[model samples]
Target: MTATLDHQPIHSWLTDMDGVLVHEEAALPGAAEFIAALQQYGRPFLVLTNNSIFTPRDLRARLSRSGIDIPEESIWTSALATARFLAEQKPGAAAYVIGEAGLTSAMHEEGFILADSDVEFVVLGETRTYSFEAITRAIRLITGGAKFIATNPDVSGPSAEGPLPATGAVAAMITAATGIRPYYVGKPNPLMMRTALNRIGAHSETSIMIGDRMDTDVKSGLEAGMRSVLVLTGSTQEHELTKYPYRPTAVLDGIADVVPLVEQLTPHESVELDED
Candidate 1:
């Protein structure tokens, strides 16, 4: 593992949402404090998530309810990255979308037109309800020469009961039908990381990505030229570290361990407390 000292002069920070900050609708230990430290030090940061079922505002409310107090603009979803990519690749292009408000709202914000036919792309995103009709429409659109795109390549997502099918799983089904694979815009693709960094006007060389998963989060950060930190509070466990070929810049027990490092990695002034 790379030493934390090598990550000096970190100008910005990025972290995963679910396991790193909150789990089961509650903020993890030191999660809020880590965020507060960053804010106190004027660090540019973003809370990243692959879930595209909700918009930034919606996520902000959810996090606030969980006692995270994250601002709307500080949240970056895979939906937003996909929208930005499409907008840049084919500005104002029409598309057949299979997603909820999060994905649709992003397209709307990027001036994309949503349609069933005569479209340039077939976009797939995360949603609680995956209608067969929508899937059929997406397959048909792809077969008709429309490009296929997905917000993230996650096969399943965590839930109270168990894992639920995600965008990648549906994308696989669509590919089986149309023989055209959708381009995934989220982790472990570095595109999502780069897009998020660009959104905050931060450079990857000076940014550190903190995540719990080695496959998506850590890999994406490393590929994006940013230092990566893996916390043990999520899916990946300490014993599982040796299973991966690559390693993170640092590993810690949880987000709590990162709070003090926030000031150590960034340039900040010290304030003296008067004796009582």
Candidate 2:
């Protein structure tokens, strides 16, 4: 299908990864072409995700296996946002991280220390398993004066069988225990969107955000003052648009429709895969 994109020709693009470009482990139709189009046109773009389990390198490899060619630097995560937020709040502060490499490595990059005791933040994020033991420890830390922070507000995420408990779900449990709500650093909290834009040196006025979920991706983009697009390939359905007070700038079938618009918006240059 041809692109339904506007004539405004957004100079910068920010798009979500899992549902917008791929579903589960499979790349959606035209996802690769859309990435290639962005690169070929030399328009700055970043693939955004709230999943804190996998690092960028790990996610890049996973996408490569699915026929998507997003470079490590071109991807942004909630982990990165949380880390940056923590660093800005208190440079070199310690944290009791309850997450995987994506969340922990980002803290390390910002020169933050990871410890089980005397930490300033209880960094909560997604993991393969949310053990009861870990939750108890996090609760104790928060109660003992450690601040609460979470990657995203997603209560659950897509799974093969159904939705699985995500970061927000775990965060809720901790909140129930400590009565301290976490400062969520990911989408729906425009800080994450702005951080991604800053990472690519893009401005909100000239950039556009695309994603499958209106609650997070579209809402965050709107809150960030960027144009938003809701692709009906993920969590949000077409009929659900009216349920929200705000609306996206455009709604397309999927990323397949975005390539033509990218080609029309910028000058074409050749983009190729690396011979690793």
Candidate 3:
């Protein structure tokens, strides 16, 4: 429906990465052109993700391997949002972090001192392997009066074998143990979307939020006042849309289908390869 005559004029854009642009390490069709369209139109945009495992530099390289060319500055992750949130809440605070390089790097960049104990916050993120030792330390810290923060709320993610426990699942275990709920700072939270929009100088009204999941990307965008687009390329399916209380502005098969609409949206734009 994106290429139809009744399409709205989108001044800026935000899109999810995994299912919308690439799936299982392969760039989906039209993923490249969709990004090209945004640049051609001189539209300020950011690619959003709930995964906090990789930094933008890492993600940029991964996307490149999949044939999608996105600059490091154009990519936004839960780690970045989490870091921004912590920094705003308390500059130079200490945190007991449980995650990978993405989360740790973000905390360090935000002037957070990684503490062994007696920290202000317990930060959790995604990792290939969840350590009992690490989670135990996190529980101990949170129970000791440190605030609990998680990058995203996703319970499981797809893998070659099957679904694997994600950050949310681990957070649930911590919550169950300590009787404390961790503040999720990723998608489905308006804070993440608003932060991304602010970084790109885009307004929710003029921007479009595109994603494969209705629960997070679509819902968060709608809640943040942006037009939402539900793509049927990932976790959420067509039959699932009716289950949600809210709806996207439009639905499309995948990002590949967005190419024509993008071409039309930036007719006068001098499209170029953005290599930053």
What do the candidate models score in CA lDDT, each in turn?
Answer: 0.90, 0.88, 0.87
Judged by TM-score relative to the true structure, which candidate is superior, 1 or 2? 1
Candidate 2 residues 112-218, lDDT tens each?
Answer: 99998999999999997889998999999999999999999999887899989999999999999889999999999999999999999988977889899999999
The better-scoring model by lDDT among 1 and 2 is: 1
Maximum-lDDT candidate: 1
lDDT of 3 by residue, 152-243 (tens): 99999788999999999999999999999999999999999999999999888777798999999998998999887778899898888789
lDDT of 3: 0.87
Sort by lDDT, top down from the best: 1, 2, 3
Instruction: After superposing candidate 1 on the true structure, give the runs of residues whose Cα lies further than 4 Å from its correct spot.
Output: 268-276
Off by over 4 Å in 3: 1-8, 266-276
Error of 2 at 209 (Å): 0.3
Clashes of each: 0, 0, 0
Best by TM-score: 1
